[model samples]
Target chain A: MSTISLEQIQREMAAAVMTPLTPDDNMRKEAPDGRSMERVAASFIAPNSRLTSFERLEIYNRQYWYRVLGALAEDFPALRTVIGSRAFDAMSVGYLKAHPSRSFTLRNLGGQLASWLTTNQHFAARRADLAVDVARIEWAFVEAFDGAEHEPLTLEQIATLDGGSYLALQPHLQLVELTYPVDDLVLNLHKQEKRQATEAGVKHDEDDHAPAKLPPIRRKPTYLAAHRVDYSVYYLRLNRGEFHTLRAIRAGRPLGEAIEAGVTTARVPAARRPQLVRQWFTAWAELGWICAPDLDRLVRST
Target chain B: MKNQLNAMLLTAALSGLIGGTTVAHAATTSASKTTVKAAKAGLQYVNGDKPAKHSCKGKNDCKGQGGCKSSDNGCKAKNSCKGKGGCATDGSKMPKAV
Candidate 1:
């Protein structure tokens, strides 16, 4: 009799559990390697009086996919709404299978969704770019909700800086340049989801209810920052100049250079530039965005 | 001239020119709708905690009272009030038919 090691047994069971279910959501009768599932199941799972070894193992297979799928649905509710539940399910399966859960927490599951959608556009049902943007904002929401917090620099600290000074943005702040005005769309979808979740007190399958219908979203180049304020996540809109300037500063550019980068492409007139930059800084300070940059680096650069 | 202009702008901004209503007023221009506002979203569910409404047929709406566990018709599960109890699938898979 061949004695199996505990590790070997776990490997076999795990492989069996993760195998894609049949169309009917049942465990396949045969393994992908053409081995009889009955024989394979008997090797590990003991048959109960009412259930065969295959049937017993099937329970686990079903539970694994169900829990993971439902978990993903919870995280990307907005994405699911954008590309109806039916397509969302398909995308979830493909994404999970490719990047199987490696982290102890499922919170990290949809981290790769936006990048995955960039290549797998068909999953969005013709709303490929919009789907990617929505996925980006949705994931940003997750990060901003729990990302780190840092104290912003005061006006005195701001006054001491020349154009060569370096600045840091808050850790929780996320910047996204989008081709669609998706910030509003995502917020609306989330509100609509809450309304439905409240009304039915349940989120039913796509078949039971009509597919989610969304308003026609026109393409508009929008720059947004998803940031945390008083523990609540807020979406702040930005102009082209502000976005690039912040981008430059975040990239470690000195204040002068960052402002120069911002000013050249700025749409605000020359006379308005100074006043506008001052206002942007005021908002940044009020919003606690301009945290202290690396002191050593700042000192060295200055 | 541009570099000099940028330096002057930086000097004027960094000086005690904040807290002025003139600029605060400018901040509210229609194009400058940059106010901070939070979205009051109440959707709640952990990763694996089956949503209370996750019914059997891949529809997570609800499993009303006294319904069948695996049937397509309006059959509710025996345990409607039981929360986070266990994963009970009705033989339906994702990205595919239930």
Candidate 2:
């Protein structure tokens, strides 16, 4: 028996687990580096009294794909609904093939999905843009839901800040400007799914059944602020002006400049600009979107 | 010591290949553990409140049409628009300003 190094064993285990499982005969043919499935299985996996070597190895292969496929589906139901299940399944296979799970956690599984959807148009077919929008919003939801928490800016802090001060938005707050009203569409789909689950008296689990088809989506420009407050995610629909201003602020613009940019770009009449800005600021402050700068970090950096 | 160093190098190489510093940081930091629960807690489906009712053009026009009077903040009062295709408050309504 040849002594295999730990690296070789780890690499072989990784390779074997990633291979898509097939029927007994075909499994060997698809083994990495033209090695027979039995050969590869015997080299890495130990056979039990009840289970053959190939069967033992098959467990890992099936498990790897199943776990990742389930995670991706859970993360991007709207994307799956937009593209349909068959295409979604194929897309998952292709995506995992292109970008396999390297992280210890499954939360980062769909991190590259937006960019992947951009390049892989075939998966989305005619609804590529809509698919991309859904992917971005869903990913944003994932990030906002549990990405990071920051100290929220208080009304007192806002009062004390000078015009030269730059405001930082909370790390959990994500600003998404979508071409279509994808925010409403995603929300509606979730509503429909929940309603269906209630009616059927079955708990809503993504792995249980295929998501029902969604209604046709209209192409109206929509702005959404996905933020977490008290450990719950909320999607606030923003007008164009509010979106731009918030976008500016999140990009590290000064408070005075961000307000000015929002007012100028507002679709409403000039007379309404100031009121709109005030309303937006009041609402944003209430929602705790602004983050107070860390004085310790500032002092250290200086 | 040499074997330990090699293992550390391998782990570093694997981390680089995976390439999510936040997630890697999360693996080491206590904060990341709380994140898993927080993320799941926030995944509860929340539907946006219905668009605020517009003013009627005529006196009779507003009659029979389901419209909740908007407060000064532009959001309907709590339980004001309930059950009328109003906002689907999953249970608790978050304070929202339209």
Candidate 3:
């Protein structure tokens, strides 16, 4: 038989959605608009609610979207804070409309939100750049938590690699460059939410807590790095020198070349460059950011 | 006779292709897994909460889950132009009036 037409499938899908089922493994495809559940069931809903069909299907639809939206909101709370509850709800509706959840797993839903915010007409009216930046930071935070881990480069590894060897970062490491001070905005908004919740407790029975005001905007672009350490995610704000060095290292540049990029961008004096580089490496080591070099293992594995 | 036999065979094939019984079974399995996962995630149904039966003296008398049950499972006022708003502890202030 030929594959079902897309239109027919969509109609059938809509019919499935509209149908409600009873507890006895039966389908009740009745419209909510005062229609008889029997007729609706006869037309669309399959006999499935009793043992588990309708109950399970309906539960999946409800919970899948709920979890995805919940995770999205958790990550992009700053965006929500900025727009307030009303607009944020509207924004979520628009976002879901543009990017419906198709994944079997709901954790993947917010991956497209940053791009959606940037390109979608509805979200475009707001501060698009800042909104996109916030979304990016949020996405980075989620990704950092979920992505696989790798041991960072260690001093011993650096010593063995010498001049010509290129360094590769772990898959779990993430670098985000944003035009706005997104991290600061999100942190401030989170703080405000906590404070409001605290104050609401203090005042007793008054539900009129206005949202906290937005912080003063910053002009400079921000650089951020997110990495998993000790099974917990930590985001560190990176300065120009550190960001450049890390980027170079990630690009598989030699240790000397990476430090050179850091030096040039950092504009440190010739005499102090070595000392500065040492300090940076030392800091990274102390933070559990580096893994020992394994050239022999790399050779044997390849 | 041969034509009738061919028609019966065709019907049997179509029934097998449709496979209503198996489709129903598979759907039930899928839905059950979803329910188990949702329960694990701590998302309960609208009707999941047990209705509390407590009469409060003042507006904010009852605090916590065991308080009087409202329509949405909290304090809901009636016939006072409140329109789904809760009365305060003093039974004077409304959510919107504040």
Candidate 4:
């Protein structure tokens, strides 16, 4: 008798976005409510000669899931190899449930997948921490490669740095500390995946094999420095001394204090300490990883 | 009075027939409105033919094979393995209930 309420139409739209449609589902406008799922489905598509409106809607519903899942699968190839196909697909579905696509672009679909994987019930049963670590590394690679770039600290700026000034790293540069050799594992798994892909004419759904359990991490926490260099991206791993020194510098400590912190954290040998510091500074300078202090402007203001 | 009632009934029936068929005609026009169905995906190297930008469900249903690989990769078709062949390259194939 009256027009369909906007709220009812919206509810149906949300339902369509979230779930798959069936041919038998009541989407036709024959009902009194005028909110038939059939009409809503029909509105989005034309009636095909072969298939009904419900059947046509199924194509889009399935494609939406497949596209999002495909992006996640591409981002975490190593993770897929470790968990196998079935478990990975299940994990992907669960992640999508918790964090649906909020961004306009599908590229941002799996923004929260790494954290979700870390806490997922399935992951906890296996190498949950390792999975998260691998995901973090993979995401960092994606960001570094595709993210916007800025002017890196030039060699000229590093040459004139004052002794009392501290160096600042770029905001894009990210530091990650992990308990597992996730980087190595991720690389190894990718290689194995390529081999398996070549051998099989078609990938089987049964490729979901449990990953081998890893030995307990005995080394100090592994430090990773991720940033873009020139047009390319690279992740230069840091040792204990290097990691501590960079951490102190990033904390706005003066060069002397940063060196002290590195010594305290890593217990550098007295004989090799000076050489290590020199080498570290030279490497940082060469890589243009450090920004000079803006002391001249500060002085003028004061 | 009886004749007038019969004339009204005939008019109502004729209108109903026109209304239903018109709705059907509108639907048919909408279906064939578009001249081009599939657009070019632009990756000429992967598959020999220019990839179809648009697709339908059974388009890749892979009836030729038992099942089709389900991937959301924008480059490849959903169910059908265009020219790249099956999941041999990407290792993406349909999951069968085991």
Candidate 5:
């Protein structure tokens, strides 16, 4: 105790607290670094009149799991809907075990969820692809809500650019290519959650809100731009051509090349190409999704 | 020739944006509802008035947010939209992880 530094104490306590809970949600009798759990707790945490050091430390262990699990639940309520409360809870535990709270805020808790789901598809259960889609769209919502915003380039500014001029989307803008039209599914789940939250006057616990069997959602190839307008976010559906074009722009293709790339992929015939592309630009401008990149920020955001 | 055609098309698109007359949430907003295929959950109101709300830190300030906002501060001006930012209202840093 005399020689141990404060940093060493923090590292030890954090490790002990973050150890995985047993299936029954109790602290293990052992620690990862191969020390007696009781002795480890007694060294750092002092025992009080009633509770021993190990017992007091157990409270923190239980709480560390509870708080992180709950925060994950809030961030991905819709994913909880797609996969039941039991599986979501279990998967969340695994996710946290794999990717613990690295950032200062829990806002980035599910940052790697969609990517993680791809590798851990078993947690997705019967509808693995749909679950992945739901996770992707849900994470997009988190990003769009708090991700950075930028002043969009004006029409006049856009006009001067040749095909080679670089352009980018707003930092908060997220382009998601999903297999199912999960945008609607998430909207329905969140709306249901809000209504229930309002009526119950409190949010639901995991077991409390184990949803009843829902009609299976069908697969539909969907292209979406999850973007913020005036601070409120929306899922703007995009045609394939528009999706590819915008993707190219975000990828740092020049304006002319990006448009050409999009034009080639346009599902509509050449005659209707101009009309659809026109509609996309008008909506994007109105929504302020187009931005002139700050080179450093652009590199990091992509 | 293809580049010329693209340039022409780009010009027309820019013209619509600059004109600012045609309000085009059509491709964006209209399609959101029209394409819904979903399963709804928790329709029953189990708790009345002040229901059984729970928070980790014991203060219930955060409203449940979905893919959308709970209380929409609809677009006030064309440029500024209302959104719910971070809501960690525990008023203390120690219990933030709790």
Candidate 6:
């Protein structure tokens, strides 16, 4: 008998657990050519009196997939609702196969889901665009929930702002400009799910648990701000001008330049520009979305 | 030779056992039903009881009206509840449409 090193054992275990489950076989045959699924399972897993070695290993394999799938479903409830349960299950399995959880935390599991769904439109068929929008917003919510935090700019600080000064946004603040009004859809679905959970006194465990029936999706330009206030994530609706201005600011544009860009929006009337800009800053300040720029660092750089 | 024979017999028995269990598992799982064995194993992870945040309670206009209603001037948008209710700054309010 050949002695297997700890590294080899770990590698084999990972391969076995990562591979999708099979019906007749406990492991997929995609393991290294020489090591059959049975051989890999038997090598590391020890069977108890009641369970066989393969069955013991199978337990881990099934749990690994279920854990990941459950995390994804929790993250993207609206996405799951948009595409029915059976399709969601199949799509999630395929997505995990393509982009396995590389990070230690399950929080980053669906990081690549929105992009993945774009290329694989067959998953949602005609509703592909809607799915993409929901996925993006949901992922933003997840990111904002535990993303980095920063102190917001105080009104006193803003009172003495210079034109040359640049403003920064909170680290967790996310601005998403979407084609369909999916922000509303995501929020509605989230509320409905919560209501159902409350009324039933138990959370919906099934992935395909349909949310209350939603209205037909109509294509309308939507802007959304996903930000955390007091450790809770909330979605704020933005108008066309506000979205453009904030996006410019987030993209590192100076405050003056960002305001100029926002007010110059073709959709916004030229006459109402000044009042609109004032209102935007006031509301953003109240919401704690703006952060004071590091003036010391800026001066040193200059 | 005796050890090899024992290994072969064990392999055969394991294959039969796995096949039967797999079929049974598939039938129950596909129907979105968990079997007693699976339930006992505690396969599902329930999320914590933190309720969804309601920071944007009156803000969201998913029900249709009062989002970005266009006034005579242009788009008069409100963070929540249009026309001078909550949130002091009415940035969306313009003098009159030009």
Highest TM-score: which candidate? 5
- Per-residue CA lDDT of model 2 for A1-302, tens digit only, reads 57799999899878888876453312344585788878887886665545566766665576577667767876787787777776888788889888998876566788899889889988888888888899989988777656566655544554566545677777778888787887778877767655665588743333423434566778888887787655456777788878887888776676666666665677776555545655566556545566766558556756
Residue runs of model 4 more than 4 Å from their true location after superposition: A1-15, A20-50, A159-167, A170-172, A198-220, A227-233, A247-263, A269-274, A292-302, B1-75, B79-98
Mind giving the per-residue lDDT tens digits that candidate 3 earns over A1-302?
34567777466545444343333324444544566544433343334323223333343234334444454564566776665555555567568756766664444667788878777736535566777787787777556554655555433344454445655655555788888866767756655655654576532221222333666677577888766543344567777777787788776565556666776777766555555565555445434344443567556755
Ranking by TM-score: 5, 1, 6, 2, 4, 3
Native-referenced Cα lDDT, model 3: 0.51
Per-prediction TM-score, please?
Answer: 0.73, 0.67, 0.55, 0.59, 0.77, 0.68
Candidate 5 residues A1-302, lDDT tens each?
55677888798789988998888777777998889889888777776555667766776787677767876787787889878888898889889989997765565678899999989989867867888998888888767655677767765676676556788888777889999877777877877776877788745474644533667668888988776543345677787888898999888887777777887888677777777777767667666677786889657867
Highest lDDT: give the candidate number: 1
Residues forming the 10-long window of minimal summed lDDT in candidate 3 chain A: A203-212
> Number of the top candidate by DockQ?
5
Model 2 DockQ vs. reference: 0.03
Error of 2 at A165 (Å): 1.7
* Residue pairs in candidate 6 whose N, alpha carbon or C atoms collide under 3 angstroms: B73-B97
User: Which pairs of residues collide in candidate 5?
Assistant: A163-A256, A202-B53, A230-B80, A230-B81, A230-B82, A231-B81
TM-score of chain A, every prediction, order shown: 0.86, 0.84, 0.68, 0.72, 0.92, 0.86
Give Cα-based local distance difference scores for all models.
0.69, 0.63, 0.51, 0.54, 0.68, 0.63
Tens digit per residue, CA lDDT, model 4, A179-234: 67666666566556555666884555334566545545444468776665433345
Clashes of each: 11, 0, 12, 9, 6, 1
Clashes of 5: 6
On DockQ, the stronger of 1 and 2 is 1
| Docking class for candidate 2 | incorrect
For candidate 2, the per-residue lDDT at A195 reads: 67
Q: Which stretches of candidate 3 lie over 4 Å from their true place?
A: A1-44, A47-64, A102-104, A121-124, A153-156, A195-212, A291-302, B1-98
Task: After superposing candidate 6 on the true structure, give the runs of residues whose Cα lies further than 4 Å from its correct spot.
Answer: A23-26, A29-35, A155-160, A203-213, A293-302, B1-98
